[model samples]
Target: MCPPGTMRNSTGATGIHQCEPCTGGHYCEGYGNTEPTGLCDPGYYCPANRSVSSPQPGDLKCPKGHYCLEGTVEPYPCDTGTYQPNEGRTDCIPCQAGFYCESALEPDPQPCPPYHYCPEATMYPIPCPNGTFTYDNETGLASEGECQPCISGAYCRGGYIMDACAGGYFCLSGSYEYTPAGDPPPANPDQDPCTPNTQCAGPCPAGHYCPVGIEDPIACPNHTIRNTTGASQLSDCRPCPAGSHCLQGDPVEYECPVGYYCEEGMPPEECPLYTYRNTPGAASEGDCYPCRAGYWCNDTGMVTFNQNPCPVGHYCERATPYPEPCTGGRMSTETGRRSNEDCPLCTPGYYCPNDTINVHGIPCRPTYECPEGASLEVVCRPGAYCEGVTGVPPDCPGGYYCPLGSSSYTRCFFPKYCPVEVKCLWNVRLDTWRCHILD
Candidate 1:
C-alpha cells in the first residue's frame, strides 16, 4: 500500500490497482510514474557496507557513517581524518587542523597549512624562521628542519648543517666546527691560543704576545728578554744587538751572528749553543762551544786544563740521555730510578762498586770491587770476598741462602753468632750449607 500522496496504475488491464511510488524514505522529482522510490539526502547517513548500482537521478546513498552525494544515488564511505562530501564524491577528506586540501579540484585533496616544514639540512623558505629554518635539497622543493646554530666559532655550510666544521678548525663561536663565519675570526699565530687555561705560559706567564693571525701567548724570542711582565699586549719591545729588531713578542731583538744573518722574518736562526756570536749583544747560549773532556763551561782553567769545568767530580761526558742515572759522582733527578748505568765510575777501591747496592754494598750493583785500604766484610761467589779489619768470614743462618762463595764464619741474621764456620762447610745432616747449629 502506498502511504498518502501516492499514484496508482489504474488504467492497466489487470483488475487490482497497483501503487506507482513508495512513500516515506523515497522521493520522485519527475511526474509520478508506475515505479518510483525515495532515497536519503546528503549528510543523512544510512547503514554501512551498503551498495547502490546504476543510481538514478535525485538519489543519494552512503555507508553507515557517511551520507550519500547530494544529487546522485552513488554510495561512498568517509576515511579517517576527513568527512564525506554531501555531493558526488566517492571518499572522505581530512578535517581542519589535521590536514589540508592541496587544492579544491582534488579527488581526495591533502591538507597543508602553516607553522612547520619537513625534512632536514639545507636552509630554505627565504627568511625561513627565527631559530627555525628549512633546508631545501632538490631545486627548492622540500626542506628539513634542524637545530639552529649549535656551536660557536663555526657554522653549517649552507645546506650541510647536519655535520661539524670542515677541518683544522674548531667550533667555539657556535655552529659546525668546520664552517667559517661571515667575518673571519681572530687569528692566533705562533700556536699561542689566547683561549683556555693560563697555567702553562711559556718561560714567563703574562709576559709574551700571541702575534698576528694566531692565538695564545708566545715566548720571548732569542736574544730578547721578557720585559712586559704578565703578558697582555706586545708593546714591550726594546732594542737588542746593533743589527736586530724586535719581532713577534720579543722584548729585545738580537742581531745576526757573524756568519749567519737574522733569517726568518725580522730575525732568523739563533747561534748554535755553546758558541759565541753577535747573538744578544754579541753572543747567545748556543754560541758557547761544548767544552772538550778537559774543558767545561761552568768553571775556568782553559789555558792548560779543563775550562768551564764540570761541577766537582762530574766529567764532561756529552749527550745527556733520558732515564740518565747519577754519573761520575754527580747526583741527578734520575737517581731515584736507581739505573746504575747513570752513576760515575768509583775511584779505584774507594766508594767500592756495588757497596750501596742490595744489602748495602757499593752504590752501584754487581760491584765486586771493594773500597781502598779497607777489606770487604764478607766474600761472595764469583771471586767476591770480605776485605775488612776482621779476618773472620761471615756466617749464614738456616733458611737463608748465600751466594756461591759467600762466607765469613762469624755472624748470621737469624742467630747472633754462628756455632762455627756456618758457610763454606758441607752440611752434615742435609745436602746444603751447614747453617743451623744445635743448642
Candidate 2:
C-alpha cells in the first residue's frame, strides 16, 4: 500500500490491476484512491511518484536561497540583505562582518562606502560620527574601524578630504574643525598638553599673538614677556622703567650700573665728568655726586670722587673740579689741601722760586740771603759774610774790611810795600785802615 495521498488501481474480486503512482505536482497519501491528494504545501516540492511507493522521495521544502509555493517544482530567490549557502534551508541568513547582502540571494557580502559603515545586515551605509572621518586609504574597514579620530592641525567633516588649520588657529586632537583665536586653554592640567584638549579660538592667549588660521600662537616681542598663556591685544606689552634697561626678549629689566643713569625705554647713560653715582640704578641727575676738594676730576662718564690728588704747586678748594695754582711768592708742598690759604710763605733768607711748585722755599746762593720782607736774595752787608739766615753774617777776616753791601772784603796791604809786623783794621765805609808799628 502507498502512504498518505498515494494509491494503486485495483478491482474488488479480481487480482490487483497494474499498480500506479501519483502524477506530477501531486501526492497520494493512504493509498486506495485513484485521484491525487491536495496540491503540495508552500515551501515544499512534489514530484511524480514511483509505482505504489508509501512515501514520495521528491517531496521536500525549498532551500535557504529560494522560496517555494504550493505545488511548485522550483524555488524563487530570497530578498536582498540575506544569503542562502546551503540547499533545503528554511530561511536565509544575514551577511556578517557588518556588511550588507545588497542583492537577493547574494553569494558574497558588500562593503560600505568611504566615511560610511553598514552595521550587521543593514540595508544602507551610515555616515561617520562627528569628529571622525574615513579615507580611501582605509578601505575594507569594519563598522567599528570605519571612523578615525581627527588629529591636531587638521579638521575632519566625516569625508575623505581633511583640512589644515588656518594661520593663527589650532585644531586640537579629536576636533571636528579648526579653532578660532583668543580661545582659552584647558585648565587644571598638571603638565603641558601632550594631546589636544580644547578647541582653538580667535586671537591667541596672553604673551602670544595669532593671525588668521594660525597653527600656533606667536611669542611676544622682546622685553614684552608675560606669564600668562594668551595675549589678545598689543597693550599687554610693557617697557623698561626708570633705573632699569631692557634687551630683546628679556624677562625682567636690568638695573642701571653704578655711575650710570637709566630712563624708561632708553639705554643707560654714564655720569658726566666730575660727576658720579655711588650705587647702581641711578635714575636722575641728582644722583650724581660732585667732585670734591683736593681732587682733579678729569674723567668723563663716572668720576671717582676725590680720587686724583691735587697736582704739585696747585691748590684746590672744597668741591673744586680742578686744582688751582699757588699765587704770589707762596708755595704748595702737600697734597689734598683745601684752599690757597693752605699754602705757606717761603722760608727766611731763602726765596720761593717764581711759579715753582711742591716746595717750601728756594735757597739763596753763597754770600746772598733772602730778607724777611723781600721777594729776592741780596748780597750780605759789608764786613760780614752772608749765610742762609737774613740779617746774620760773619765779620770780615783780619787786616781786611768789606764795603757796605759788598760781596767780598778788601786787603789791608797795598801791593807788596806794606810794613812788616804792622796790623791793619779796615774801615769798610771809608775804604781806609790805620797801621801801628811794634811798640
Candidate 3:
C-alpha cells in the first residue's frame, strides 16, 4: 500500500519508483492506491513535494490578499481593482462603486476622494471634469455623474471648487471663469470662459443692468435710464428727472415738449386748463404759468397766453377760464379788459343796463332825470322841472308852477297883485282878487 502523501498509478508496483507525489492541487490520504484521493479544498493550496507520511508536508492555507481554487498549484494574488481581506479565500472581491482598489494585494478598497469619482472595479479615482466641481469635503463619489456642473453666477476651474463672479462681471451655467465687458472672446471657449458681448456672460452695458447668473444684459425700463456702462444691478438705473422723459433702454433723457410738463418716472402731462407753457421742458405742474390777464383760456394745454382776448362788456382776470361780464350800470367798449375796474360808469343824462358794452347808455327823456351811473330813469317832480341837460330835477322858481314830468316852469298870472312867496291864483270865493296862502 502507498503512503498518504504518495500515489501509484499501476495496480502491481514493483518498487518505490512507481509511487508519485499527489498532484499539486489534490490531497492524498489513507494510503492512496492508484489515483489521488481528492482535489484540494477551496481556500487552500497543495504543493507537488510529498513526505509519504500521515500529514502532507507541502499543503498550506491561502495567505491574506490571495486566493486559491480547487486543484490549485500555487496561491494567486487578487487582480488589480479587486481585493481580499481574509486569508484562505477562494475568490477576490471587486471594488465597490464609489471606491477604488489600486493593488491586487490590498486588504480593502478605498473610498473615492473629494473632487474625484470612481466606478465599480476601479483601480483609481477620476478627477472631476473641467468647468465642474465637487464639494470640498465630499467623498465616495460613485460615478462621473456624481460630479456637479458649475452653477450660474459662479465659476469652477479645473480642480477648484466654486468662486462667485465679481461685481460688473457675469458667469453663466457651467462657467469655468467670469467675463468682463469689452473683452474679446476666449480661445477654446468650451474649456475656458464665456465670450465677451455674448448672452452667455459679460459685464453689463450702458443703459442696461446685469444681475448674477443673467444670460444677457437687461434694458432699463421706461421712465428710468442709465448712461454709464457696467451697471451690475437694477438699482444702478436711475429714475428719469423732472422736465425730461426716458424711453426703455435710453442712454439719455429727452426734454419735455412745449405745452407739457413732466415729473420723475412719469409720462408727460399736458398743461391744465387756464394754464400755459410756451417753452419746452416744463419740470412740473408748477412750471405751467397761469393764463395772463386780459385773456381767456377755456381749453387745456395752452402754449401761449392771449390766444383768446377778453370781449367787450367783459373782463378777464389772471388764469380766468371765461370772461367776466361787467356789473350792472357799468359799460366797456374796448376788448381785453383785465378787471372790473376797467369798466366805466354810465354817462351823465343816460341810463345804462347791466353788462352794457355801448360807451354811451340810453338817453334820458325830457321829463325824466338820469344821473351818472344811473341804471333806470327817474320822473321829474311837480315842484321841479327837468330838461335833457339836468341829471337832477331843478326846483321851480318863485311865483312859478311846474306840472309832473314838466320840462319847464309856468309863471303866475296877474290877479290883484302877484305874490312873491306863493304861486298867484284867482280867488273863486272872493269877488275881488285876494292873496291866498300856498300849501
Q: Give all TM-scores, in the order shown.
A: 0.23, 0.46, 0.47
The order of the candidates by lDDT, greatest first, is 3, 2, 1
Candidate 2 weakest ten by summed lDDT:
50-59
Over the stretch 395-427, how does candidate 3's per-residue lDDT look in tens digits? 767676665687987776565333444444335
Query: Which residue ranges in model 3 land beyond 4 Å of their true spot?
Result: 1-24, 28-35, 46-59, 73-81, 94-99, 118-122, 129-132, 140-152, 157-159, 162-208, 211-222, 225-439
Q: How do the residues 279-381 of candidate 2 rate in per-residue lDDT, one tens digit apiece?
A: 8887766677776777766676564665677776788765566677766566667777667767776666666655556355667666785654344667876
* Better candidate number, 2 or 3, judged by lDDT: 3
Off by over 4 Å in 1: 1-90, 93-268, 273-439
Q: What's the residue-level lDDT of 214 in candidate 2? A: 45
RMSD (CA, Å), each prediction? 24.5, 12.0, 11.2
TM-score winner, 2 or 3: 3
